[model samples]
Target: MNDELRERIEHEAEKHALLNAVKHDSEADVGAVVGPLMGENPDFREYGDEVPGVVAPVVERVNELDTEGREKRLEVVAPDQLTELESEDETDDRALPDLPNVDEDTDVRMRLAPNPNGPWHIGHARMPAVVGRYKERYDGWMLCRFDDTDPETKRPDLEAYDAILDAIDYLGFEPDEAVRASDRMETYYEHARALIDHGGAYTCSCPAAEFSDLKNNGEACPHRDKDAETTREEFEAMVDGEYAAGEMVLRVRTDIEHKNPALRDWVAFRMIDTPHPREEAGEYRCWPLLDFQSGIDDHLFGITHVIRGIDLQDSAKRQGFLYDYFDWEYPEVLHWGHVQIDAYDVKMSTSTIKALIETGDLDGWDDPRAPTIASLRRRGIRGGAITDAMANLGTSTSNVDLAMSSIYAANRDRIDDATDRAFLVRDGVEKAVINGPETGEPPVHPNHEERGVREIPVEGGVLVEPDDVPPNGQRAWLKGYGSVRHTRDAFEFTGDGIEVVREEDVPVIHWVPADSNHPLRLRTPDGDVEGHAEPGIASYDPDEMVQFERIGFARIDRQEDDRTVAYFAHP
Candidate 1:
């Protein structure tokens, strides 16, 4: 890479890495520096360290998407593009409209209805955190409503639903109850029948091409004039499996001439030929549209508040119309913006990130790059860190794209007070010959006098970081620990001659004896690191988080045998 490109990548990586660090370390200094930048630069355009030549390829690739595909991508890539519809202009003669009142005393029951289409993504995790906060603050319940209306989307791997429930519980947001839309189909059918009987819905037999235009154009169809009795017959026939998939649909007789396109006649229910994972194929022919079903469900369940992403603002409006038509109370809604990490000028999505995990382009979902909750947890990011990050961006209607360094810094500060310290050899190198005292012990942490330190068992031969050693006969000392001297051929071992390097160097890394009965293996950036147990230090428990003295924070992964142990790093 050219200097400019290399610098850009490094800068982006550092910005993202900083958030990971804060969440692990809880660094206040970082917050002081980046907190003010949150809303001041909502677009994050000024942070572009991109080279002039690098813009062409990105522009070219984005241009390849079709119009509808581009619109779909905008929700994730550029949510600011979304525009809300304006209500009719108020005239002086018109009566003032009454808005719904919300207050502390309001019984605000909110819900998060996520479709169990695939594994829960970062987006899914974000919903609960946002909604749960409101519920906790207002003493409300955030119902976990499973939007299983479209049976095709429901998978055989029901464990994904269980995982989300588990994740919600782990995050301390247990729902009051679980409700599946599939089980409530009878209620949806009742609403469809009501609409048909009221002459507000009709059966449309338009082909795909004609329906595509009808969906957006706000143009009436010939079928819209069908009598209520005939329409009701067709709908009941739909219920009784008279229509095939895509052959006929019950559409609401919304104002087709409305300027706001989504307000036009919308599909109320349709036939799905696919099998339901939870039921036999062809058992049910009619399925309610998402907006209609959600509207009815929310009203029936008495959802007093709806907290969701800004991208779904239109969904709230559609449901609002339904509330007006049915004369039901509408819920108060709060639309929070999306979290955008600095990714070298490209936006990221949970689906794309998940694909990277499955394809081995990245590690599992917990991989730091994936941005999933598991990834954040695996990175030693405390829950307080994420909460702090969200708080940094207070509830605002404005959109904000942030460099992740700030959040990482928050996490780092959280773990700093509790982290224990230890020495680590990133790459193996033997220590130089003993020059200071024959034996010495390094404190686990610099300022911690009472916590005590792990003793290093050193002898004539010891290992260290290879890069820390010098050529020829030179001296290196391990700070707090004993020293070592290097010679061309100072020692001999039973294996390859590679073991003959002198054990003395400048503060060479300490290591456990290779022949020790209890050996500890650690996962680091380079690979697994092997060590021996200290004489007095007790074996670490599975969840015990400790600093390897000079090394970083780590949690015990497993106790393989009585003598074998594994450790994984965080942050």
Candidate 2:
């Protein structure tokens, strides 16, 4: 082989070796890398017999590195593959990275915190799905905590609390404990007083703009050196409702010169006068910030592992000082990159959806067009599909746009078996089928025979989708029923068997009896699709998924007084 070819072969070999080793605990196998190597690099075909010899040494080189070392090098060599490897078909059989500092005897505890602002969008499911998986792996405790502290900016919705727990139950990862930060104000106040007495936090009365300037410049405020007694007195006053909104704040005593300016005496608590929707939560004028609230709760509730987003890495740094002051061990932290869903029309924000709903632009949280968990459940996207999709993505620390195709594929796998096949003719054109068969039996489920059949009553005329019509004098088959010859504005029954359409390569499409079918209005993400379906369509219970042959899958949304309605899922 030429020098260029030799270089290419060695480079490819090392790349595959690193990937394989990273996947299998820093241990690579020559056999695993060889097939992918030769298959992807067809130019090495002539020398395929010598490929194993080249890959064996590469495996040795890769196996010499530890797990982190191997993964670090892989990121440098091929970053995208690190994510793709996690999202591959191996998700069903692959294992996640081991939880740090964990053992068989360790008491494992986990938590998922939401603000209770609105229903969880698809992006919001990642953290709980990941933590829930870990909880199962170690038989740990899981807590669903509502971080509803920001009353002014992110006011808590009265209804989202139950909706979130419902989503968790649907995902099959219900937590052992459900809590709200707002309801635990006394606990937070007690901790704040203790921290103040310990000289770990102090009251800061600086104006908002001044604090921003000082924090940005890594300069400590004048109040940082106040005595603990003074700070405690001020904190008591604030808890006693002495300070108005934005008049003063409480900050942790971290290093002012920390390299990351965000860690410079970050706000631990603030005063918000906005009345909370919940009567119990509305009584408090003082609120703890997210970091301080979650930091204290993590230790108090015994949360051992924390699944966090990469954007919030600074939160860990900010909380580390408080842990130091209290002599507490921080929880095991895992930060994954963002999962930006592509090809989804809706913005993945709770506040945005709420605004749209208020403006009459959206129907509700469960609108078929929205991407909330409630919407997904209503649209027949199973909860298992969401969790399984997160498993396939894993915890790779590279922000990648999760393709819509993966979600569709996962949902398709979940619903394909239970879904019964039926016919839905869009923009139907009635045609007289001369001497047509009176009765036809199509399997309710194409893959399962014991499920029985859907009796499609064929009358003298059939309703066919306009798009399925063939040219004049062409043969067509009403799927599973019989063959018919197309005439001018009608069909002539030609044979009882399907062989003619199969042998002659004729068009075959789904059909419904013109006289016996019911009206259907399919509400898809795009818009409403009006059509006709077989009489058996009404037999399905609400929320049951059905496959309209050659069209797509849809969920039985409801039974309108005048028609049957379904939400289109996917093709």
Model 2 C-alpha lDDT per residue in residues 342-409, reported as the tens digit of each score: 54577888888888889987899888878788887888888877887777677877886665555665
193-291: candidate 1 lDDT, tens digit per residue: 876776767898887679668767666777888899988888889999888999999888767877777767778899888766765333776988888
Which ranges in model 2 have alpha carbons more than 4 Å from their true place?
1-95
Backbone clashes under 3 angstroms, per model: 54, 0
lDDT of 2 at 438: 79
lDDT of each: 0.57, 0.81
lDDT of 2: 0.81
Candidate 1 weakest ten by summed lDDT = 90-99
Residue-level error in angstroms, candidate 2, position 433: 0.9
Specify the highest-lDDT model's number. Answer: 2
